[model samples]
Target chain A: MKKSNIKSKHIINHPLFLPLVCLLLVLIVNLIQTPSFFKITIQNGVLYGFIIDIINRSSGLIIMAVGMTLVVASSGGTDISVGAVSALAGAVCVAVLGTGESYRMPYIISLLLPLIAGMVCGAFNGFLVSYMRVQPMVATLILFTAGRGIAQLITGSFILYVKPVQFQYLGSFLPNVPIPTPCFVATFVILITWLTLKYTSLNMFIQSVGINPKASHLVGLNSKMITFFTYVFCSVCAAGAGLISVSRTASIDANNVGLNVELDAILAVAIGGNSLSGGKFSLFGSVIGAITIQALTTTLYAMHVSADQLPLYKAIVVIIIVALQSPEPKRWYYMIKSGISSGRSAREAN
Target chain B: MRIFKKTAAVILAIMMFMSLAGCGNNKAPVSNDSSDTGTDEKSKSIYVGFVQVGAESDWRMANTKSMQETFTEAKGYKFEMVDAQQKTDKQITAIRDFIQKDVDYIVLAPNTEAGWDTVLGEAKAAGIPVIIVDRMIQTNDNSLFTAWVGSNFKQEGYDAVTALENVLKSKGIPDTQEINIVTLQGTMGSSAQIGRTDGFAEKMAAHKNWKMLDKQSGDFTQEKGQEVMESFLKSYPDIDVVISENDNMSFGAVKAIKAAGKTCGPKGDITIVSFDAVHAAFEAMIAGDIDVDVECNPLHGPRVEKLIKALEAGESVDKIAYVDEDVFYAKDAASIIGKRAY
Candidate 1:
């Protein structure tokens, strides 16, 4: 019994525990509101249900949050330009595909072209933040404003539409496919990133640089190089997300494709128990965090919440969850618990 | 690193100069040669400066195309076109530029309803006729512009609801039968959202059996529309109709309905009513996925041109000129889908 208690305690104290609890709490609330929340049915050989929809819709944010975790861990600042960069990447890909002229370019070339454009954009941001020594937020703000404009310019200020069957599979389910393609894509990315970090010392180098850049530099770590790579990797992730989004709609709107998604990515990082100041991070935690947000949105919609009041409800719940994870509230809760236990022990002695 | 910095700065400088040169090139033909041409055909050709609100969507693109096609130099009009890129201040600057150029008329499509009073006062003082197109401005002074020409958005909403009612009636749903509806609104607080929501609700109130199951903003995007419709499917399984504020949202709703293993359209379980009779909406209608589409015509070019001619001829124009539009059912959509400009 004692051993079991200790194991349970250890699980509770784990870094991913809070986000899991928050997600569970939301799920339970939803189940209470509608008992069928967890029910999954297969339709036309594909999973058709609310839970599947949440997972599928969250794939873009999950990919974005993975890259964001690395950047936050390395540089101690957030990239506000991920949304715009995603727009630019999608625009580049769609422009090359050339609206109903998809036969002009091979599918692979269309896909690879956007990823390359995203790398260049990421490299520019990395150079500004690493070499020029500019603040990450300010450096990213340049692209945050101009990136969408650049995308508009690429498509000549028109929403580019493509009708490629191969590309549609990225966003939709194929014949007899039981899962959404984006879910598989997101999982593949997460697994690859996890395996790479496990086998290589890149994770250690990033954490050390994030913890103390000057000390890491003195110890022969190329901090600038690490920071630059992280930004580039983050941009690649954003590009992947952009491709999924454009595929979902089969069209690209420069103004609204990845609109305000950076905020959600940052929020996911924070909700995953990672400090905005940078240091130790969790990629899995961020994934769970992204899912939690999508679940919350799904729950709100199921509850028949008005669209205008959604932001207000979201803000209230987010504040409560974040405060529960903060240091001050935890400290207060521990103090109160110890005080009550000590008083009970004294009463027993008397 | 130093060499890289120098090269980057040079590249940026060159880019800046090129953009400035592009802007200068656009302005040169309008101003430098205008005086020469104005002297040659002073009375025959009337110079008109048109300020557009940018091509943000296909509708806006069609609107711009209409203006370009109708107001050409070959048609005896010297047209100076300026795209404001959805910024009110840019539109103001274009108006001021037009005033300085001494153009006979200025056609303004204001991006917002606020902040136009001051610049419009300047246009009025300069004695240049300004015809407001597409959107209205909030000016206490009535004479800030010559006329306002656009669609009555409220009427468009009423037409959409009427079309939906007709579909429901044909499906054997009596007026006394309780009808469940879910509304997918546009961006909240937008003029379209406010007008359409109010108009539909007002008409719906007259039907005692009509009930609004849920109303939420889809932000006029397909992705949001799909997500919202998915949730609505979970919340209200008995939804009889979906009133989408635009065609894009209806497209999304149709996808969601299909994904949920449910049929949509007048012949199906749910009837979808939408605004903005874009080509895609007509295609959906013909496919029997959407039941009704009320036209919110974006092509105001010919109407604005006609008004401009009237003003030049010293004829008085109406205070508010509304363009005529029609409501389309699935049967009628097949006939007109090819001729849709937007």
Candidate 2:
């Protein structure tokens, strides 16, 4: 068959198309509501207004969601501890680098160490889940509940105000531009991860475990090794997110940094048409989904909705998206298949 | 399969039984002592039931300590402090349990103003004086409690605004220029949120140039405060001022500002101002990270002692007792930070 012949089938088979459909629907509605919404303008040599700001601000979620998608797809597991992991990593980096009177740390070490710490924590989680045979949820739950406490205990609870000029430049934007550094770092990581998955046997093994761990183990695949690496990778991703987060803030307090980010990343992955039950993954879709969620919030804020009402709106949007993306009812789905099959048979007889 | 099923069922049942037993053991059994002699002639020590809002932050811990330290047996009161862990239903249950035990007076720092009138009314009908401390409740009836011993929250907000205005004036910033202010409000519908926000809004009205660019509830946590402040910085590029309802929240905002590569406090890109005279806030101010502090005066220990004394003497005290406070800056509180209890 020609490549064009397969292109039509690809649309129906692909999971990532669902979020694209939703995104289009939202864009169409916005276009109808506000005629000027689709327009963009440059101000003071920088892109301005609600949509741009939303995309820039949601870089952290986009990066984390990409990592979460892989972890979920590979091991049928979720990392609810990423937020705390990020905080702990940020705190560790700051604590090691900071002096009580003034903060001073070399630029490269401050940026690299937190991610390293986060990977170690993630590896710890992986070790328990893969080797110790603990449930992923249970293994990560300890970190989710107590990681921030540990972070605070390590950092002494006060916000570490670091003044290293070189380190401060990591999360800073270009002169007179609104483009955040996290956005660039997240985009680079996403590209690297995408390339790595495409070029490696790790991708196939990860998919195998996700499809059925029993089958992978029977085939002599190193299921535990794959599972362990998946979590470690996820932690590294979260560490990157945290580094950007703390850099964006120029200070780190273990108690409050990166709190509830797990929820945002999970929501982003879900909105990107990834399954909570696990199997398939989409990094690009998750990035768009993250921006979409942030955009919706920014739009709501611009519309003057009360702060209390924002959560309600977020819940409603999530519910609607999840419901629409959910697999069709079994009976209705079978009915449609049977109807199409019968029609095809009739055409063959003709 | 049947044997495995049975084993799982047995284990689950045993776990449930153990948890039930654990909960039963965890609760401290109330002891009733009716045998004490000689003290009965001179008004039995008033049993005080203090249902705290939990140690949510340093301020809450200070508030709890104040109640406990003041309402002691030596001060003619028996204090039973129940930690509610910041849960409303739990606090309500604790209050009901206190009422069942028939305490002389009930002190409550409610999680929120709603769902309180009924409980406070119940305490009132039981003839138990309910002292509202550190925070306020929503009630139309003033007779529900004897007195409210707390700082003038609205005044704290006014004081913050006053300090901000004076600093701006001293810096030679034009009073006519519209100053972009972002506020990290406490828990929504909380007494602190209401009083502090309203006070600042009212005072800033006189200075039409001072405009609130964004106001979001931080839920009184350092994390949410920082997160919201990050969004505020993104939303409003030139947010010149950050006003937090408490020290913890202001500290969170300071982090967000610094992360955004903006300066904090005097001569910085963004000025950090907040309520609560906690040691951390003082330290931040001394370090030039914070510009102003509106004193919330968390040392209500002496006031709690005075209230208990009046109750023991059978003397009717004022309906409300205001805690005296003053606004402080880095220079003003240089020597006093060490003396601060909380």
- Please tell me which predicted candidate would have the highest DockQ against the true structure: 1
- Model 1, A1-350: lDDT tens digits are 76996797698779999999988988999888978878788865678778998999999999999999999999999988999989988898888887773556877887899998788778778878887889999988977887887787777777666766566678777656889999999999999999998899998999999999889999999998888889989989999999988887777878888899999999999999899888789898899889989999988887778888998999988998888789897688669877997998899999
Error of 2 at B157 (Å): 3.7
Q: What is the TM-score of model 2 when looking only at chain B?
A: 0.75
Q: Tens-digit lDDT track for model 1 on B135-193?
A: 89898999988898888889887887788778987889888888899999999988888
- Taking all chains together, the TM-score of candidate 1 against the true structure is 0.92
DockQ of each: 0.46, 0.13
Q: What TM-score does each model's chain B reach against the true chain B?
A: 0.87, 0.75
Clash pairs, model 1 backbone: none
Model 1 misplaced stretches (Cα beyond 4 Å):
A1-9, A164-166, B1-40, B72-76, B169-178, B309-316
Q: Name the top TM-score candidate.
A: 1
